[model samples]
Target: MSEDLPIRKIIHVDMDAFYASVEQMDNPDLKGKPIAVGGGGKRGVVNAASYEARKFGVKSAMAGNLAAKLCPGLIFVRPNFERYTEISKKIRAIFYEYTDLVEPLSLDEAYLDVTNNKKGNPSASLIAKDIRERIFNEIGLTASAGISINKFIAKVASDYNKPNGQKTVNPEEVTNFLEQLDIRKFYGVGKVTAEKMYQKGIFTGLDLKQKSLEYLDENFGKSGRYYYHIVRGVQNSEVKPNRIRKSLAAERTFSENLSSEIFMLEKLERIADEVSKRLAKSKVAGKTVTLKIKYSDFSLQTRSKTLPYYMSDKSIILETAKDLLYQETLNNSVRLLGISMSNLNTEANKKIEEKSVSVQLKFEF
Candidate 1:
């Protein structure tokens, strides 16, 4: 097992219902009730939901009004970003006490490369348990950890036992673990991609492993190479600390396919508004406006426009996206639509402003 694997010690830690749990912790009156944290207004979507809410089928990204209908007694609490940020800092501090290679995926989850940790702990499993214990003892929040040789499997292992538990995928167990795992459950595979794999009769990691790299590449594009390697329990991407988001986006998969020009134009306006708000919170802007389209036939296409200056305001983002959408020729009735900004500029670079211009390029996913 040691001969076949590099034997790296990676750990992925994820907090359970972070925002919702924090709300419950800070307010005793909220305990034992189904609660969701986010904007709960008519147009808002849930950001996090307490475990109690899960019974009622409430989920993050679910429309708030829909969630209310599902869980009639559900409590809505506006997010306290300052508090969540404070807690996240404490959690990161605890991880840094073990290893400096901490890659934060979001405020509630991170990947830690503890191959050579400060504690001189040889057992990654023990280290993970120690970290979770520290987080719970110090912050009063439960965290789940996954331990393994690489980031991909470690992430998968972390989910095996969630909300205050941990799972370790040892070197000896990597092969069988991958074989039995469902394709849909793999870390990076999304619903659309999973459906594509299913259509090709690839239902599990074992099934995915049967395809040649050439076949995968032809069928799935660049991500095919990614699938080929991770299924065999081989992934070498380092746990990079201080990673910056390359793009900020907002997209929606409609309940029904949209082919009407009027319907799509309205959807794009709404999506652009959402994207602009996210960019504002991040205090960033970008020069590239990317429009992503997924058809009902499951085909995907991306069109992008790069402006001379960064624009994060809704009006500019909406206009640029509209331009890109109009230029493209839809191959089928659209099932999904997205707008994203890239070539990001942080708040520090906010001083430079230039008139927006559209330059279109096509990309395949």
Candidate 2:
């Protein structure tokens, strides 16, 4: 870590089981029950699971049937995007009260740069506390926050104390905090990557730091450099208020594998409709349409076509997907189908706003 590098107060705010929490808040009967906000049918995937359900190993993206088997008493509620979006707006509005450098990661979480803020508060931890308190009082839901010198550490810290709690890693504590951290807890390391790290005997941040840059690069490629820097607290990514979305997509897994094109058209129609609706909601169009197929054997394939002009209409999207579907003969039965749009109109090269940093500045814990 270099003392000359910039020090900015970054806070990551994540809503607690956002979709399930909203359902619980709206319906008093669901307050303490194990609830999942999504379809509970055989083919359905759990979008979000309440904390109560999580104790039984129910989690988002788990198959509804598996979740049901894990928590037999779980209740399922359909998703209401309009309601979630409405509440998300209110939460973001609260964030803007303190900082314009707010970067939303999703409807349920965001990164806020409050090194200098409208409230003129010098303590980022205090600001995070205030923000969480306001969300609870105003939105009728709980939120968790992480405060630190950068977005990565802040994101990791936020998970330390969850479901209506906050964690702060001070500037002086950053190195020790990260060194003692579990390899799996590092933000970007998923299950597969963690397993790979385990095979390489890198099970902790200290273990990761012990590997040479050459050794890591030889073993992990480009991500090797990323691990080297982030483990040593050298991430320089900023919070961009206008982060552009690169792509939009919608996908569904089926209860039964479809072997013929006739059976797929109906599914394609529904998938295209979803993609179109999402594109319209974002108010963006794309030039490329992609068809994703997941075979019954779990082999994945994608076919894409870049159009001369951008489009966001359901009819056009469905037609393009249909064309891609018919472009090739079925290699195997497909258990999942997806439609995606890329080269979006939202993509653009915009200058990132720069801020000045003072050398050896003091940051409150």
Candidate 3:
């Protein structure tokens, strides 16, 4: 939409095997070993598996038993979410140092719009290199970055050189790169859609780009517009800062089903800490706090309470969540616990003065 302005510079940064890497970083002995950071018991799932484990056919979301069968000597450890959150915070602080137009996709990835950055770097590739180096030196983690004129190209470029690497796609190379890409590798083309495309002889970006808009729309519906633009290197998406949250939740699946109140309480404290940190980072406060419990049978029940005022403090959030949990009746052992904060201050008077100052600056600009 803002294409009339100077061609925008966007970067996507993704950490390689974030959870597995963090686990390996914490325990030096786990380095170069087939380690997974989830599931050590029956009915457990793998959250993340190291690259070494991946060589033996291990992957995230695979059943722990299946992963063990794939790699007989695989080591599994419970996730340390608190440590991961701490590291994410440190990395995000570094991103803000360069630009306020940072949009975090998750704890391990983000899109940065550096069109007019605080550091005044003209080249997005150099900024990406600096960010990746800073992350490695300061946070002890490997990050891969992609720099391009738009989000689509930037996302594709970032994956080209992964694990402490960076890649850039200039405007001139955009069309040629897309032409050779496999149809399946195009972003947003899932397995089912890719199979359909293959059956229709649309095996490459070149083939897709040749199809008329009406034809693509007939087959792919609303997403056809997206495909048309991306195939032609015409992405116009913006990197929006301070994106509002629809719902904020933190959850953990235990290594074993826990019926003990003490063990569950300890886990709740950690989850509360994570939720509080996210709330603080986003500068949001919620009036409602909900506690969710999933039983061993996979059935879930939730209980929530709304306070008169918004809360961002860790202790207050935990106390409120604990009270909600106490009020609910548990019929079975819980395999997972979740805490969500919602009903945000979407319209509060805190921004009135700020908006007035911004309006004045707009006229001056």
Candidate 4:
């Protein structure tokens, strides 16, 4: 680890099987049973699975029918986003009690910088413990947390002890911790990237650290620099309290695959309406309009057009999406259609540069 790198108390908190847990919490009959949160109808996907369901190899995003096949008698419950959002708001309220420097990644996870928390607590580990305990008590939900010197390590550690647990990588342990970490477990390394690293004979952080910057860049392009620093426990990105929206999107999977452009036009209109509503609600518009198509074979294709002016009108968005839709020939029957707007007006809302800690702080939990 470099001596000049920032050392701040960062914590990543993630709720356990949030949607499934919420369903179980609300319905006593669903407790202690294998359940998945999402529609069980054809074309339905699992949004979240209970631990009992997971034991049978059922997981989120799996086809609902496949999940049922994996776990015989697996119960599927429709998603209740409104209820989930209600619970999420309560959980976020608890975070604000400890620190204003809270960054929510989603309704189920967040990152908090508690180095200068309201409680004046110096032990980030204890702070995480307190937050988890409060969530369990107040919201009837279990949360796992990771505490460390920076966001990347903290995020990784949070997964170490999941479903009601916490892991802390103290300042002194950061180097050894990261060096022993599996390359696949590094924050930004996905399945494809992990395979790429494996081909390069890089299976662990120690292996990644051995590669020169130019060597990594030559092979991995822009993410090469990210791989270089994170392996050395040198991530300096801060948790932004006001994380601005970069894009607004909406999509839907049909009950039956559409075989022609005319059938998709109505569906695209509805999707555009949703995207336009989201853009209006966010008070932002964009120059880029993208249309995403998912064939019945599960292949995805996206066509985008950047206009001279920003658009948030449903009619205009529908017109652009229709153009993009006809721009390419159908590869197969379409299972899903989506519309997204990017190059947002929110870009101007970005705050000025925020500095990370430069001096080492003597601390222990």
Candidate 5:
């Protein structure tokens, strides 16, 4: 596998605290405060929490009520999707300015393969630095970047210097770097998996590398193969640019089935807010809004509205979704309600410019 691998240059760019950062960027008054974005009501859930809130044990996906309890004076705000979508588009545009081999993980993170970049910059470190500066100057948001010969090392490098910073992992230093890294820090190793590794006395990349591939496979199942390769600084994942997006949706499974018109409408408002936020972050407007309902009896139904104009507005999206929901008769109590936006705009493309390669770093292997 190593014999066929290309000497590639990969950069992983991740925006620090994406949703929370957007909120702070939009409103200066909220800066440096413990802020959470999501539900403010009795059944509210946190969609995003700022770094300040993180210090107080607040986190995304946690119940908003619980989050408020964890941090005194925690401020909660509903999400704004349209604005986030606009900012995401601007950031993506900046990425295309460097190389077209860009693979977006989400609105705020992506991987770029610049091994044969259009700009012909020999030093991947310099390219990452340039990208970081441009994002701060143009988008008014800070981003962290990592540059390396492969994605695994690059991702770790990016996190080393975060919140408006950049770093590089040269090929020669890869071994020493991985040797000292905690086992939990290895990609694809999550909390449960890390705990299992710790039980087996696998606490660092060096320890993982010492295990035979067959032995790892017997214990970790399919993931053990991935661990074996990454510990050896081998990653084959490609920077797949222009990957098609699927499954654009928003949904809410109510705590209880509801028949009240006013209550249903309020829930639709919150769902629309979430759907819009994601749409804006992707910089794509949707032509279809699908409303889904699951009855208490485990029966399901869906209604959709196709708009003449693509939209990312919260009001327009919610109104359309509500209209679709209202079109159906509420003969049975609805237990789950969902709204999804699809048929996104795909006009964006990456562009790489031309330049001379200045220097090449030789690998000792």
Candidate 6:
């Protein structure tokens, strides 16, 4: 431990099967049962599942039919957003009591910096425990907490002990903890990156640390540096309290699938209008236009293009979205079509770089 280095007390809290647990809490019959919180339909997907359902290979984002096959007796329930929002509010209220430096990643998970909490509590572990207790006593839900010196380590540690357990990686033990960690478990290493690392003989944090900075930079680009530093427990990213919304999107499932490009284009026009309205409501503009397509088989894909400048014009947004759509070879009948804007420029509306551009795109089959 260096005397000049600064250390922080960061904690990551994640709810245990949040949606499914909420369903079970509302109905005693659903408790200790294999339940999934989502509809069972040809195109529907599971949002969350209880531990009992998870034992049978049921997981979130899985197709409804596959989830049913994985667990024949699985119970499916519709989601109640109002109820979930109410409970999430209660949970966030508890976090604020301990520290105002709370960063919620989603409704079910968040990061808290309890380094100088309002509770005047010196122990980060005790603060996490107290918050968990409050959630259980007040809301009747179990949560897992990970406490460490930084956000990266804290997020990883939170998953070390699941379903109401907590793990703390103190400042002095960070190096050893990361060294023993598996490469697949690293936050930024996705399935594709993991395969690449396996081919390069980098299976663990220690192996990753063995790579030279030049090698990492040459091989993995910007993310290569992230892995290099993370392996040595050098992550310094702060737990941001108010993260700006990165994108504003709108989507809808069609009553029937459309195979005709002309029909699909009409539907997309409506979807683009919806997305533009949302961006306007949020007062945000983005450089990228992404088109989301969901097929009859429930598979999803997206295509995006980043422009030279930001704009929220409906015509331009729709034009770009249409281009992205026609570029993709539609292999299946489309069940849903959506358009979104990302690479968000959250700065207030200004004329600094506002300009008009035109393009003529004609769809032909």
- Candidate rank order under TM-score: 4, 2, 6, 1, 3, 5
Residue 82 of candidate 6: its Cα lDDT? 83
- Candidate 2 per-residue C-alpha lDDT over 80-129 given as tens digits, one digit per residue, 9 for 90 to 100: 99999999999999999999999999999999999989999999999999
The C-alpha stretches of model 4 lying farther than 4 A from their native spots are 1-6, 349-361
Better of 1 and 5 by TM-score: 1
**How close is every model to the real structure, measured as TM-score?**
0.75, 0.92, 0.72, 0.95, 0.71, 0.86
Q: Let me know the TM-score candidate 1 reaches against the reference structure.
A: 0.75
Location of the lowest summed lDDT over 10 successive residues in candidate 4 = 352-361
User: Per-residue alpha-carbon lDDT of model 6 for 1-365, expressed as tens digits?
Assistant: 34444456889999999999999999999999999998778777899999999999999989888999999899999999789878998999999998889999999999998888898888899889999999999999999999887788899999988989999887667778888899998998999999999999999998998999999999999998777777877765667787778888888777689886778777778888888888888888899898899888879999999999998888898899889988968979989888888888863342233112111111110
Q: Report the number of the highest-lDDT candidate.
A: 2
Q: For candidate 6, what is the lDDT?
A: 0.85
- lDDT of each residue in 1-365, candidate 3, tens digit only: 33234457889999988999999999999999998888856777998888899999999999899999999899998999898889999999999999999999888999998888899888788899899999999988999999877777788888888767988877767778889889987889999999999988999999999999999999999999778877887666678686657568899888789986767889999999999998988888999999999899989999999999998888999999899888856879999999999988864443322110000001000
Give the C-alpha lDDT of model 3. 0.85
**Where does candidate 6 have its weakest 10-residue lDDT segment?**
356-365
Give the Å shift of residue 238 in candidate 1: 0.3
Candidate 3 Cα errors over 4 Å, as ranges? 1-3, 249-365
**TM-score winner, 5 or 6:** 6
Q: Could you give candidate 1's per-residue lDDT for residues 175-294 as a string of tens digits?
A: 889989999888779999999999999999999999999999999999997788788877767787957678999898777889865789999999999999999898888999999998
lDDT minimum window of 10 residues, candidate 3: 356-365
> What RMSD value applies to candidate 2?
2.7
Candidate 6 residues lying further than 4 Å off, grouped into runs, are 1-4, 253-257, 273-277, 280-283, 294-320, 323-332, 347-365
Give the residue spans of candidate 2 off by over 4 A: 1-4, 313-316, 349-361
Best by TM-score: 4
Residues 111-130, model 4: lDDT tens digits: 99998899998788899999
Q: Residue 144 deviation, candidate 3, in Å?
A: 0.7
